[model samples]
Target: MEFIDLLLLFVTLFLAIIWFKYWSVTGGGQKNLPPGPPGWPIVGNLIQVVLQRRNFMYVVRDLRTKYGPIFTMQMGQRTLIIVTSSDLIHEALVQKGPIFASRPADSPTRLLFSVGKCAINSAEYGPLWRTLRRNFVTELINPARIRQCSWIREWAMDIHLKRLEKGALETGSVEVMSNCRLTICSVLICVCFGARISEARIKEIEAVLKDVMLMTAPKLPDFLPIFTPLFRKQLKEAKELRRKQMQCLVPLVRSRRVFVQGGRCEESNIGGDMEMVSPIGAAYIDSLFGLEPAGRGRLGEEELVTLCSEVINAGTDTSATTVEWALLHLVLDQNIQQKLYEEIVNSVGKKGSITEENVESMKYLGAVVKETFRRHPPSHFVLSHAATKETELGGYTIPAHANVEFYTAWLTEDPSLWKDPGEFWPERFLEGDGVGVDVTGAKGVKMMPFGVGRRICPAMTLGTLHVYLLLAKMVQAFKWVPIKDSPPDPTETFAFTVVMKTPLRAVILPR
Candidate 1:
């Protein structure tokens, strides 16, 4: 019976391929489409994705050799336009604007993860996105607001240092990624909810976020919607995870409500006061309460929970992963690390505690951060953007609703853009076109780790500051020496972000 089932599957797939070949040759809609590898019917590029067993960007990179920089691939019924050229990416994302600003329709997996397209990260580009993002900027990530939250950053940094010191004393080494995550989570939670949550509650929120990230990772069923029933258990888990996120988050919002109203409430079981967090004026949630999303009325509890979750999840993982990569790179090159440390020392002195303000003076550290971003962007591409209307990109027509992606990894490494693209040289950022490259791609895209145009990461400034501070402080606080007989290995893996496959284990002795 099993053999018969396998044979039937192969037969169906063979027939699908034959049908696809015939259809492509005869299909009227094929005209003006970007050239790409011919795909099987129904399954489309699903088989190729499965066989590649590598980052999707690399597969697109290989396709570019035969199909040029801008090509298309079909994933199940979905058409994906892959843009590898910086100029083309700018034309689509920046020049075209709203035509390419909207997100792809929620696949089953994205719906499960986002809890129905409420989060800023996944919300369709429009009035609601604009309102939420505007509030996010004005209340949270704006320069003035970030500076106002300096106390939260400082508070988290103190805890981070003590935690690392404890680990160094007790275990002689620490898993740096976990520590980085905790520090980032602490800051974000305070920023989102306007309170310092106890370590125990922070742990609970972190666990759920991690689980949801793991579960929502692109699954085969996500591409082949017809097979979604096979992933019923995963989908169920997503629902439960969303519920858990709401349970953990909503109460904090309520508690903040109580405090904002000047009415006393029972102390949280999590055991931290809003005062303990030093209340950075208005929280992200507080701003949401004041927003009137057009046609949607006031933001509700569910949207608030999801948006705040976006705050924690977005702020925590990507910043943590980047710092981890930054540290990994620093560990691999002692000279580079020392150079960064010396710059910090010259700017703030070895004994002086580095503040958020001090990061600007550390030029070499800034370069290191940019170099790290280029070497290991949090993800290869931004969340897939959808074409809202038919458009021409690089002289090829992108039909309305076609999913579009810009491969940042490929463009960042293109030989024409950078000399010796494979080398990890921060010096490149200090000279020539690499010097002071606007990551926003406002002046032409050299490296778009955060993306470009209206959909560019609003958290870019905040995330960059978090990374620069954490990295500089770590270097200032201790000498991150590799575990004896175990030098750091710079390997790559994809998870919530691009991570070191072999996690860095290192000891930190006071500098």
Candidate 2:
């Protein structure tokens, strides 16, 4: 058996080499294709990328120097087209939105994780995606819906402040991102499920989410599904991890469903006799039980569990990371921090209660948040999108079914677009060229931290508002001080999202 296994591996590599050589000599039928490095045949650029390990973003950015703004690379059998030019991104993702809207065909790993593309995050573009996204927007992230959830944020903020205070008292410093994730998870659970849960339960859910995030990180087998059998351990672990996720999620969904059906939730008293507070239209889980996409029937319990997980996972990490990045930049750049602090004081008055309304008037605060997003987007790459059909992009042909991506962090720092693009200057958005910059890129491609076009994040409004309110309150209540011996570092670690490689440790001095 061992010898047979080795023989199979040898045969696979031999075929890959022969195919690569043949394709190379033929130039892979290179008529109007975008130029790219002649990656090794068979495995293509996978080896080079894998060698870099975690710094995939840096590797791709370096490639732009040789291949220009638009380029192509082969990952196993997959053709990945990366666009760095905002103009080309706008043209493909916005102008030709429909043709490029669909997600790529799921790899075996993604199929297992998304449970056959049932979750909104991985669902193919069509009625199913539209229905899921619409339900999410109308019930959760919509302006009015977000306003309704203001109390939840306020309540969570109180808990967060208390934790910070206690931590500062017990130990001279606190890890902001860890506490930030806790606060975010708490708020998301309450708003998403309409029930407040205990710290123990939240940790359980976080542990499950952590597993999912780790398992879903880009793997070699995912790009080349032909080798999925070799990833049996990973695939099995994914199945078990998802099962664990469902164990945590299904009960919440089922309990909510029972409550909606005039049956009291069994776990209502598990935490604090907290009857599910979200009325029919106020909660995402409640809304899912009624949705009937164009041709598909209403969602099932499994789908509900996955979609709800999507909301919790997407909302918590992205929002928390943005705030984490913002605080780090503020600590490192004191001048920018003081300017924002003064703006907040002048607008809200010293010690005045800061509210969402106040956040709107604090233009400098908004600029700071925007700059943080530009400098360190929550995710360096937008969710991978696939071309639905062969199309012309940047005067070159993008083959159908090709995976497409945009390096948002790099685009924001494009030298041609911003003056002193490398500098972390909030003033660029204040009175300079970035003034009134529309992030959606409808008017132009300035910055796209939330992405743009048809597949733009439905939660953009809610996420941005969360960042503003959290940053304002944190800045208003306390002055953050770096640990005496260790200064904050801006190094990034990519999990599900890009977070500080080292959690920001700082002392919170009450203002």
Candidate 3:
């Protein structure tokens, strides 16, 4: 080889190396960032994540342990921040709530919730998301509204008890996870769409949602921007999903509840709370369908349509998973289960039924729920947040648009926060006057089940009540035990909402 050719080859290799480094640190200086496991050039964590054959939660948690609570993972050239620290988490998420509230475009929910219409989670931080979030809490999941839906608890519990009774008679075993999913989904479906979903129908939705969820599932797509066009797998799935979703959800959306006044039935209350309303009002849709001018916050008609599906997904998914996990723990741990059961029986037994108003007095029941949330958070990691401008956290510089992710699962189990973090004992929460832990150990940076600050999940209360009431009723009606040798393994499932690795199978022994 000629000397000139050798020199050219060296130059070419050097330029490629420099370009790669430049790509990784484009938005921020990438200096003094927290550490992460070294990865193959350009690909970083993506290969590890995909290769694990799907242990995303454990892999991420393991990384956090090696790299501390606040660390970074590189996907190709894109920088992904993984926060495990409560302190910096507060600084970034809670303290800087508004700035960090925005969720970047990703697969799945972009189609499911955003419907290509930017709803709360999909809509970037702006006036439109603000209006929508406000409307959701004020109208749908408000304290009074949740209270009014007390019948949901009775009806759903009734259906579930009947299911378990029949199942035990036939096989002496039942899958509690399926029951939990149906109960939680039915409650949300009833509350949001004002409809009761039978178990078979719920299974049908779950199957379709499973496909749509995979197609739309979030990964480090930001790493491969050029591949975005190809990644429309979910986008296409979203369109098909929107059709299936409409077949079920739309009819629920359209049918108006006949108002009974003085024993007379008439046109339903459309604008009032009595009518079934979309998260976004019907007037907004009429205007959009009519091709009226674009409304506030630079939003268009397409985004307007997406809001309904977003409500269904957001209102349903994590909450159902959460309810499932909590009941699993309560049932598998007979001691804890009976302790809570006793508390419920003592408080509401003579009342012949449970009521939302009386639930506040059942402090131990509340603690069991809190402990369940702490041990098994719905999302091990939260939606990625981008710094709007240069900010400092943990004595490190987080430059503008640098993607930051928070890991709540580790934070919840961190040694600094709790005693016996690994154990499923609910009594940890039962400390301090028996009301359990009121500190909310993972709210920001520490533990964020429903997320934090301004963009905190509006459905937090609704979800909490839904979970507690279901568990409360399940306990009140029957005694739960594992199905013979079944181990309700705490090992995790990789999905949109982290689920039990094994669907909990148990026997429902009636009290």
The lDDT leader among the candidates is: 1
Q: Please estimate how well model 1 matches the true structure, expressed as its whole-model Cα lDDT.
A: 0.81
lDDT by residue for model 2 over 218-323, one digit each (tens)? Answer: 7878667767788899888888888898888777886677677875433254344345765555677777788887766877777777787777788788988989
TM-scores vs. true structure, each candidate: 0.91, 0.93, 0.82
Per-model CA lDDT versus the true structure: 0.81, 0.80, 0.64
Misplaced by over 4 Å in model 3 are 1-25, 28-32, 39-41, 107-113, 196-202, 220-222, 229-238, 256-305, 432-446
Model 1, 1-511: lDDT tens digits are 6999999999788757655664364232566888888876577787988898987766876888999888878777567889888889888888888799888777676675565787777888887788878878888887788887788888899899999999999998989888899889988988888788778788888888787778777677766665678778877877877788888888888877666665333323335533434342556776777678876787778778878877888778889998998888788789999999889889989889788779977788889999888888899888889887777888888877677888888876889988888888998888855786889998788888888898898998899999999998899999888889888888888787888888888988898
RMSD to the true structure for each prediction, in A, is 3.7, 3.1, 5.6
- lDDT per residue for candidate 3 within 9-104, as digits (tens), equals 896677557647655555423476666777765466678777888566677777776777677676655667777777877777777777777765
Candidate structures ordered by TM-score, highest first: 2, 1, 3
Worst 10 residues of 2 by lDDT: 265-274
Native-to-model Cα distance after best TM-score fit, residue 204 in candidate 1, in Å: 1.7
Compute the lDDT for candidate 3: 0.64
Clash pairs, candidate 3, are: 69-84, 108-216, 113-310, 114-117, 117-303, 429-436, 442-446, 442-447
Which structure among the candidates has the greatest TM-score? 2
